[model samples]
Target: MNIILGASGQVGSNIVKELISHNLPVRAVIRSRNPGFDSQVEIRTADLFNPEQLTDALEGGNTVFLLTPEDPASNDIIGETQQIINNYKQAIHANGIKRVVGLSCIGAHVEANTGNVLMSRMLEQGFADLDIEKIFIRPSYYFSNWLGFLETVEQYGVLPTFFPEDLEVDMNSPIDVATFIAKVIAHKSRSSDVFELVGPQKYSSRQVAETFSKLLDKHVELQPVPKEKWNETLASAGFTASTTANLVDMTQAVIDDIVVPENPDAVCLPTTLYQYLKEKLEK
Candidate 1:
């Protein structure tokens, strides 16, 4: 059986659908009951931090899809994430799970001080010694992240971003990420591997604004947030002090070009920014 953690989330939900379409046996692990999944899916409720619950969720599962969700309001986000990773390790061991598909980020190879990317680094390190087939899917910055600014773009014709207007950075669609993950899970490989996933090309904040303008039929402009104001902007968005600091550090790493794909020949998904935005708008 295949077990999907965070099954209600954007990527995980899509993975569930993709696997179900192939008529595979799946057990969806979620924190709460969600009626959105197909009736063929077996639903299991488990808190990631609770070892017993997680163990029960992984019972009889051969391959598990794992990811750590960020909690911006937590006082100790890193500590909480470590505890959850520990729980996953124990559960996988106790249930004799054979494989794990970890959802990681592009800069996860960097061993230290990349802020939020550190979480993915820890995940890789934590599971390194397990006697199981491990596959890490390291994806670029998510295109869905821009969805948060849709309201601002519609109302004010402005797109707010931390990066400079001209700095090109890697980005990918969550749908594409999910599709690749489902494929990996279906075809379990023998040796451990890392797959770096990105969109067809890199994009700049200006390019993103242009795409939004074309899709929205408005004169949307890029509004770069000054570094001095990152704190205030994040605080107004309700991030706790520590979370804001982590996010700012992560943003700076991106600007410094520190966060990057380790593999030069990383797989590029077919969806372009314009096509993704057009489909999203049509929906």
Candidate 2:
């Protein structure tokens, strides 16, 4: 009944876990054939860029969950999302997915002109013309994004970034977003609702550094890495300059409050950054 894409990723994994536990039949499409998911759900693989696979994957499914990340090529997000539109048009005309919950950003549609907003903006267009229920769950900065720096911290006691030490950004753990998606999947009544999955409070980079210190029991420092240093740092970590620049834009966007989504339903969660960090460190 439900075809969830990117089920191997964090948010997708959470959705799969919740779906299986509830005894709901789910069709999971991944970039890879082996995603190590539960056997109760059907697992399939398809290249999102390949139209035939994408269309075949959408067959017999009434709902779809889309998770498209930024591509470093062309810097044309709308152009990239157009690929999805051209590819899925046949499937849309045939299978007719009733609802689409797109995982997008706060400025997804607004930043069409900006190169960094291309992917999300394209994703916005990918579903805009569809004749189906749509809910764009644009989440704030994922707290798990910090996990990328955990290796850096383990190697060196420093966390490098483009944001200021005291610059506060809205944050939410992936658990929050995943749980919200799960709630949407479980409740047929919740649709056409654009929810801003965010943390209950705001947090600064300095506070994040403090949280890391407490979690790691080490003096982890937040050192503001210059743009040049960012290039070398990310390159050493196996990322391209375009990817680095995209992240810089997003980080600055967070600092400028350009990417903060409004609270539509005011849903509350029991976990905090401390709780999330604690469990991660323990693991």
Enumerate residue pairs that collide in model 1.
Answer: none
Per-residue error (Å), model 1, residue 74: 1.4
Best by TM-score: 1
With candidate 1 superimposed using the best TM-score fit, by how many Å does residue 169's alpha carbon deviate from the native? 0.5
Q: Any runs in candidate 2 off by more than 4 Å, and if so which?
A: 71-81, 112-116, 263-266
Query: lDDT scores for all predictions?
Result: 0.92, 0.73
Minimum summed lDDT over a 10-residue window in model 1 is located at 110-119
- Model 2 lDDT tens row, 107-204: 66465233355566667676667667887777766788788788878789888666778887767888878878877876776457666666877788
Q: For candidate 1, lDDT tens digit of each residue in 166-189?
A: 999999999999999999999967
* Ten-residue region with minimum lDDT total, candidate 2: 109-118
